[model samples]
Target: MPRRSRKPARPTACPCGTGLPYAECCGPFHTGAAKAPTAEALMRSRYSAFAVGDESYLLRTWHPGTRPERLGLGDDRRWTGLEILEVTGGSPLHTTGTVRFRADYADAEGPGSQAERSAFERIGPDWYYTDARHFTP
Candidate 1:
């Protein structure tokens, strides 16, 4: 039988609002192939994980000090979008950082969004989500 070459699969859009392909954006972070380079990057990947219901990734990126035993991700909620409001000291030269963001979603009731300022810490080469404080307004 004659052999035929297969085409490479097309890249899908990432849900992190970065205007980048999932494979080049958050896919590698989700699959353990790579680590987010900054706190903002980690925050973006965490949002993508929640959108895709990758509870494991969420937990993995969470700081062990604050990571819960498990997550209760409900299928009822559908993540819609992510907006990064601000980023502070999250570069490669920083050991700690903060990211303020808003995440939109929809469920049985209606559309809703959550805003928060998240804290991140770099223990070694990887950044981990430490905590977050909800925004009121």
Candidate 2:
């Protein structure tokens, strides 16, 4: 019997609401073809990762100090969109930065949103997510 060959599916539009397809937007970053140059970009890619349940990409982009031993995504939750509210630093020359954004989703309970101010650090031309302070409203 011949073994079946598994092929990767084509990437669709980015869930971060960039309007561009995933291959043109965050896919490069997620696949290591490119790196996020700013905190805001990293935040967007991270959100996209969550929507697709890409735990490996999420952990790889997270700061080692804060990254958990493992990551799990709830199948019951469906991520819808992302809105970037604000950004500070995280530029090409900056070493640290913050991004404030809202991620919309729906779960077993109902539709809801998460607002967070995420911190990022630039280490040798790469941006890594450090932590976040979640907000309620």
Candidate 3:
């Protein structure tokens, strides 16, 4: 008898719009298996966290000075997509950076989007989300 090889499972698309598998793109960052290398990466991971309602990961990567004591990650909204509009600094050598983005969502009311230019700071080797300057949605 001949041996047969099992096919690998297909990967699910990451909600961050990276066109990559969730496991490869944001799963490691969410699970603490790996850290985001750049500020934009962190922002992408944060958006993914929101999409999946991983509040712990969101708080963990937030700047301690700004992190909320607790989160209410309810099921009222379903995060649909992310759009990275702009990026500044956020390199390995820079301590600060900004990422402008729009996060799309759908709720009982209807589909909507939130746009903001977010700031990030690097403390040691890890990047943390600082805050955002909101734009009219």
Candidate 2: RMSD over Cα atoms? 3.2
- How accurate locally is residue 97 in candidate 1, as Cα lDDT from 0 to 100? 99
Q: Could you tell me every candidate's TM-score relative to the true structure?
A: 0.90, 0.90, 0.90
Report the Cα lDDT for residue 107, model 3: 99
lDDT of each: 0.90, 0.87, 0.90
Q: Write the per-residue lDDT of candidate 1 for residues 21-106, one digit (tens) a residue.
A: 99999999999999999999999999988888888899999999999999988778888899999999989999999999999999
TM-score of 1: 0.90
lDDT of 3 at 4: 46
lDDT of 3: 0.90
Error of 1 at 119 (Å): 0.3
What 10-residue stretch in candidate 2 is worst by lDDT?
A: 3-12
What would the per-residue lDDT of candidate 3 be over residues 75-94, giving only the tens digit for each residue? 78888889899999999999
